[model samples]
Target: MSLPDFDTFRAAQAARGFDEVVARSWAPDEDVATHSHPFDADALVIAGEMWLTVDGVTRHLRPGDRFAIAAGTPHEERYGADGATYWVGRAEPG
Candidate 1:
């Protein structure tokens, strides 16, 4: 799928009840050890590639790919050589 503009992405997330949207980038070949967040996340890759691991399953993600993780899920991340950039929508559980 083609990538959406930030405005469009933010609007879509808001419509889906996400409270905030932001851009995030990782350095090339970076590895983020296992961690968890306090809120749910919905994200789309905007550039480069990454490996996302949740529940011990790893997914390779490239431009235009989307992923989601539930609040408090333990996950790990590794960025491709060229690094990665993405737009993420976050929502706190009600």
Candidate 2:
């Protein structure tokens, strides 16, 4: 689904208690092999595109697109032809 602007996304994440927030960028055709995070997180694409695969399913994400991943869920990511930049927010465990 589409996401709000970067500032709004960050504010929402903060409001939701996401303690770790950062901006990340990927180069053209960059690929991240299967991996998992220790904490649940959400990402909001700010520029270019990304192809994200979670549990073997892939979806295209463009600017303003957002996605969430649960802790420990295996996933892979590939940047678009022109690469991408996004903001990620990690939630603290209760």
Candidate 3:
């Protein structure tokens, strides 16, 4: 199946029982509020750089990098000077 465009990605998330799905190009200094999810997540960095805080520990993610996060984890994100574009997936199995 073909991948959905960024505009329609969130709909896919809803269809799959995901709390949220985000896909966008971020600018430097962009910040995502700290939050917790109830399911597993996979994030892929498409360009630039970012720092993700997971359970109080921060991990840097760069282009071509991917990360998986477990359920019920608290996390937040900060963009780097060059910013970043990423695809984030969050889902719970039925």
Provide the TM-score for each candidate, comma-separated. 0.97, 0.88, 0.65
Flag regions of model 3 displaced more than 4 Å: 1-22
lDDT against the true structure, each candidate: 0.96, 0.89, 0.78
| 10 residues in a row with least lDDT, candidate 2 | 1-10
**Clash tally, candidates in order:** 0, 0, 0
Better of 1 and 2 by TM-score: 1
lDDT of 2 at 34: 96
Across 8-85, the per-residue lDDT of candidate 3 in tens digits comes to: 656665675667677768889899998877778776677789999987899898876778788777889899998899
**Candidate 1: tens digits of C-alpha lDDT, residues 16-76:** 9999999999999999999999999999999999999998899999998999999999999
Query: Over the stretch 1-94, how does candidate 2's per-residue lDDT look in tens digits?
Result: 4557667778889999898888899999999999998988988888999999987789999987889998888999999899999999998566
* Number of the top TM-score candidate: 1
Rate residue 52 of model 1 by lDDT: 98
> Could you report the Cα RMSD, in angstroms, for every candidate shown?
0.7, 2.1, 4.9
Ranking by TM-score: 1, 2, 3
